[model samples]
Target chain A: MKLLAALLSGVLFGVGLAVSQMTNPAKVQAFLDVAGAWDPSLAFVMAAALVVSSISVVLARRRSQSLLGEPLQIPAAATIDLRLIAGATLFGVGWGLGGLCPGPALAALSTGVPEVWVFTASMLAGMLSYRWIFRVAPIRE
Target chain B: MTEFTPVSATVGGLMVGLSAGLLLLLRGRIAGISGIIGRALSQPLGDGGWRLAFLVGLPIGAAAVSLATGRLVVEVAASTPVLVAAGLLVGFGTQLGDGCTSGHGVCGIARGSKRAIAATLAFMTSGAITVFAVRHLLGASS
Candidate 1:
């Protein structure tokens, strides 16, 4: 049941990404390009997503167990430390360079674009390297 | 500029939110791609079934959309080297930061985490600055 639910959610999320054209790196870059010809479509994506998820998050917060009787796994770390700031800044620069974040990149894989494959491969390498170097388990947040 | 797609974007956003909500409500999991992928890579031994199912569903769902719509437009403007660099940064940085746009931007914001908010601001600002440098200063075509 849990696996089915996760699969369903993943499908829905991917559909959303493709439908919104968030899978398009050029569109994402345009949205980030404030000084250039800016497209505000992605803003609506974020706003609308927030409206729905905020309620869900709030409701989930009030409960210890999920509707499936699984323990709630929402992240509890609230520290605004150097790691968060530096890491996010670095990720942002990379996002601007390629305009491909993880979710959209994964969704775009279905497009059979060679660059998408390259990016995804390199991204995985980077991730594994981080683990290799730090030897720390990836955080669950 | 790309064609503004407010309607599709909004609808898609709602769907994304619904997915996140459902994952949280049903499985008690945050729909964070980086965290999901990261953990799946790190801990491939136990509890890999749901993660694999979810990951597989992403591309399949996207393919379903492409089939239904006849086309899914995706233009990656970055060159191979740039993409490699970008991918490395994103992967390593998300691992270090503990979240990406979906985790921090969507779910974390919804939960009103100060860390997520700060991280979002940092990324957004840096993203804009990077774009400015690349497009405006570096004279790269968008």
Candidate 2:
């Protein structure tokens, strides 16, 4: 049942990404290009998403366990540290360069574009490299 | 500029939010793509099934939408090398940050986490600067 729920969630999320036209790199770039011709469509996406998720988050906070009896595992880290800033900045640079974040990138894979495959493979390598260098289990957020 | 898609974008955003809400309410897990993939790769096999199921569902959902709609728009203007570099940066950075747009931008902000808010601001600012540098300063074609 847990797995089914996760699968359904993933499918819904992917469909959302596709419907928003976020799977398109060009559109994402345009959204980011504030100084240039900025496409403000993505803002509406974020605003709408925040409205629904905020209510759910508040509800979830009141519960110790999920509806399925699993322990709630929200992120606990709260510090605005250097690691967080640096990492996010790097991610943003990459996002600007590629216009593909992890979620949209994964969904865009269905287009069967060779570059997407290459990007995905490189991304996996990058993740693996972080593990290899740190030699510590990544902190779950 | 890309065509503005307020209606579909809002609907899609709602769907994304619904998915996140469902996962939290039902499974007690954050619907963070990078964290999901990273943990699935490094963790022991016993608890990895759901992660794999979620990952598999991503592409399947995308393909399903394409089949139904008869079109799935995607354009990668970056060269292969550029994509490789960008991919590496994104993967490493998200892993290091412990979240991405979905996790930090959507779930974290909704929960009112100060860390997520800071991280989102940092990335958004950084992304805009990078775009400015690349498109205006560096004179790269988009």
Query: Highest DockQ, which number?
Result: 1
In the range A48-72, model 2's lDDT, one tens digit per residue, is 8888899889899899899999899
* Candidate 2: tens digits of C-alpha lDDT, residues B42-78: 8635463888888877877788889989999888888
Docking class of 1: high
- State in Å the error of residue A140, model 1: 5.2
Per-model TM-score versus the true fold:
0.97, 0.97
TM-score of 2: 0.97
- What is the per-residue lDDT of model 1 for residues B20-62, given as tens digits with 9 covering 90 to 100? 9999999998988888888888765447377777887788888
User: What is the TM-score of candidate 1?
Assistant: 0.97
Which residue pairs come into collision in candidate 2? Answer: none
User: What does candidate 1's lDDT look like per residue over A57-111, in tens digits?
Assistant: 9899899899989999888897789989998999999999999999999999999
